[model samples]
Every structure is written in structure tokens, then in C-alpha cells.
Target: MIDIDIRPAVPADAGAVLDFWKTAAEGTSISDDVAGVTRLVQRDPGALLLAESDGVLVGTVIAGWDGWRASLYRLAVHPSRRRQGLSRALLDAAEERFVALGGRRGDAMVLEANEPAHHAWAAAGYRREDHWRRWTKPLA
Candidate 1:
């Protein structure tokens, strides 16, 4: 097992987390704008967890709960750190935090075509309930 430390993400962690996000978002529908990420980190500092190895941020998962349901997003692990179970550890930590915050259920939206994500979610005990055909009307 890789030696990693999981901690609540602070504003200072934005840059490192963004680096992981850039790589993870490739070939996927998930997109996170810098300003948006900044706001999110600020809004709920503890909702963002950073996984560090040798004092370097290598993984991240953002979770939130609003008294009813909890949700997880932006779960990314550095390519070099993949397949080491760090992502699972991070997800588990996030779920624990949400549950402690009174979350009764958890949810996440993954691209329908992302098999890896589906598998990961399933492996982590998340089950799909409903499917929706999303539509986007871009205003250019």
C-alpha cells in the first residue's frame, strides 16, 4: 500500500488539485473552471479532500451534503498514482465526512460512456438508479 495522507483541502491546495483535474478530465465530459473550483473550495473547505504522497498532492475528491443527500465529484488520482487504491481511500474518507454531516444518501453523475468510472463506482458500492439523456443549449 502506498503511504498517503488524506486531509481537508484548503485554498492553498487549489493549484495541485487543478493539476490532477486537468489530466482526469481528458476524454471525459467533466469540466471544471478555475474560478468555479476556487469558489467551491472556499464554500466548503472540508468537502474537498487531498491525498498526498511524500508531501505532494496526488489525488482529490470533492464531497458535499445539504442535510439530505450527499454527492461526490472530481475524484481524480494522478496517473502515476493510479491503481494503488488511493482513489478508493479518498472516496471512503469523503463518504465518512458526508455521513458525519447528516447525509442519508450519496449520488454522483458520470458520463454514460465512461465504463471505468462506472466500474469504480460499482466497486465502491454505488448503484445506478436512473438514466437521463442530457441536453445542452450553448449560448454563444
Candidate 2:
């Protein structure tokens, strides 16, 4: 097992997390901003999980539970840390969180074009629900 610390992100980590995402994560969303991330941490302290190795952030995943659903987003691992057990470690932590909170099922938001991520998610026991489609509208 990798000797790393897996914990919830704090308020001060917002900016650094955003910077990390730019390099490690694929694609982006409006909530990718520091301000938005700060708000998320402020609102739900345990939702954002960060993986640190040797005191440096290497991966992240949002295990959001809002009473009704367990939703995941922003699952990213650093390039140098790829092919290791970090992703599984993170997902295991996230799933444990969901079970602790009485979450019946967990769903992830994966980009359609991210083939590598498809393999990872599949390896993690997540399957594609082709019958479902995500609908979004920006609230500007």
C-alpha cells in the first residue's frame, strides 16, 4: 500500500487544489475556481478528499453526499502517480464514506472522451449507464 495521507480538504487548500487540478485533472467545470471550491469546503467540509504523498498533493476526489444521493467528481491523479493503487485507494475511501453515511449507491461524473478514465472507473467496478444522460444548464 502507498504510504500517503488521505483526508478532507480544508479552507486554505482551495487555491492549491485548483492549481493541482489544472495539471492532473482532465477537463473543467465552473466550480473548478478557487472561490467555488472554497465555498464547497465551507459548505460541506468532508466532501472534498485530497491525497498527499510526502507532504505534496497527488490526487483528489469529491465524494459528495446530499442526503438523497452520493455523487462523485474530480477524480484525478498526478501523471507520475498513475498506474499505482492511488485511484483505488481514493475510490475505496470514497465508497467507505458513502456507506458510513447510509448512501445506497454512488454515481460518478466522467467525461465521455476520457478513455483512460473509462478504464479506471471500470476497473473500480463502475459501469456505464447508457440509458442515462446528464443534462446541464449554466446558471449565470
Candidate 3:
């Protein structure tokens, strides 16, 4: 097992994180760009969590807490680094952050079609809320 270091993303890490997501993440979001990520880092520095090994990026997860709800997003692991506990490590860090911030529960956004991700989430003890549907309109 490699020594994985999990930490909050800094402003300088935005570009690399974007590139990592393009390869590691299953799908892209409107806020996956450099500008959007930079804005996120500027606003909430500890919201974006990253996992690295020997300075190379391996995984990422966003634990967003807005006083009431704790939302998790962008959980991704490098293709070459999957099934090695990277995702679990990232989630553990994210959950710890949320708990520290007085967050009661955590919600994750998992794609309906991503079966692998679904299994992973289940393994992490997160179950899908079949009663809820996501509705959104792009601002751009």
C-alpha cells in the first residue's frame, strides 16, 4: 500500500485538479473549469479534498457544507489507482470535515448510470435516495 496524503486543495491546485477530473471522473460538471474551481477555492478553501501519493494527484472529493446540508461531489480516483482504498480515504477525510463543521448528515451525488460508482458508494455505507430527483438549470 502506498502512503496517501489527503488534504484540502489550495488555489494553485485548481488546474491540476481539473485535468485530473477529466480523466478520473465519470462525468463533467459546469463548475469543472479552472475559473469555477478557483472561485471555489477562494470561497471555501477546505471544501475540496484531494488525495495524493508522493506529490502525484490520485483522488478528489468535495465535501460542501452550507450550515444545514452537507453535500458530497466529484468523488473520483485515478484510473491507475482504483481499488486501492483511495476513494475510501478521500471520503473518510470529507466526512470528517463535515462532522467537524457541525454537519449532521452527508449527501453524495452519484450518477444513475455509473454502476461501479454506485457499488463503491454502497461499500462506503451511502445509500441512494430513490425518492429524490435532481433539477437544475445552467447559469451559463
Candidate 4:
């Protein structure tokens, strides 16, 4: 595992985080812009986990807990930083946070087309549930 600074993202980090996701993340989502990120940090404060090394943004994961469910999203690592243990560290931090907050299961929203991400998630003890399908409707 390489040395990293894992911490929750603050409101000030919204822009950098959105920029980071452009290169690090696999796909796009509706709530991936500055306003959405700022709202997330303001609403939960601790949901967005960021990993920095040498004062640079290297990775991120959103460990969202809505007081009932643990939802993981946007698990991303810098292209140059992949295959290391950053994902593991971020996940460990997220999982620990969930457990501490009375969460039982930590669920992730993984893209089906992202095969590389599949290996990483599986390596972290996350499994896909074929029985469950996500249904979403954009409010906007």
C-alpha cells in the first residue's frame, strides 16, 4: 500500500473533485458537477472520501449513508495510481464509517461496462446481485 492521505471532501473540494472524476472515473452521472458535489458535501459532509498523495488528488469514493442504507458510488483511482491499494484503503475507510454509523451492508453502484472496475470491487469483497436491479427516474 502506498502512502496516502484519506479524508472526507469539504465544500472547497467540489471543483477539483469534478475535474478529477473526468480522468479517473469510468462514466458520467447527472450529479457529477460542482453543484451536485457541493450539495453532497454540505448535506452529509462525510459522504465523499478523497485520497491524496503528495498534495494531489489521487482517488475518491462516495460512501453515502442516508441514515438507513450504505450506498457506495464513484470509486475512482487515478490512471497512474491504479493496481495499488488506494481502492482498498478508501474502501476500508468507507466500510468502517458505515459500520460505525450502524450500517449493515455497503452497496456500490458499479457500471456494467467497466470491466476493470469489476475486478477491483470483487477483490474488495463486493459482489454483484443479479436478483436486484436498479430503477431510477430523473427528477429534473
By summed lDDT, the worst window of 10 consecutive residues in model 1 runs over 24-33
1 versus 2: better TM-score goes to: 2
Cα-based lDDT for every prediction: 0.77, 0.94, 0.92, 0.96
Query: What does candidate 1's lDDT look like per residue over 41-89, in tens digits?
Result: 7887788888898898888887976567687877788878778898799
What is the total number of backbone clashes in candidate 4?
A: 0
Q: Candidate 3, 76: how far from true, in Å?
A: 0.4
Q: Write the per-residue lDDT of candidate 3 for residues 25-118, one digit (tens) a residue.
A: 9888888788999888888889999999999999999998889999999999999999999999999899899999999889999998999999
Candidate 2 clash pair list:
none
TM-score of structure candidate 3: 0.97
What lDDT does candidate 1 reach at residue 102? 84
lDDT per residue, candidate 4, 43-137, as tens digits? Answer: 99889999999999999999999999999999999999999899999999999999999999999999999999999999999999999999999
Which whole-number lDDT from 0 to 100 does residue 44 have in model 1? 75
Cα error, residue 28 of model 2, in Å, equals 0.6
Cα lDDT tens digits for candidate 2, 21-64: 99999999988787899989988788899999999999999999
Error of 4 at 40 (Å): 0.4
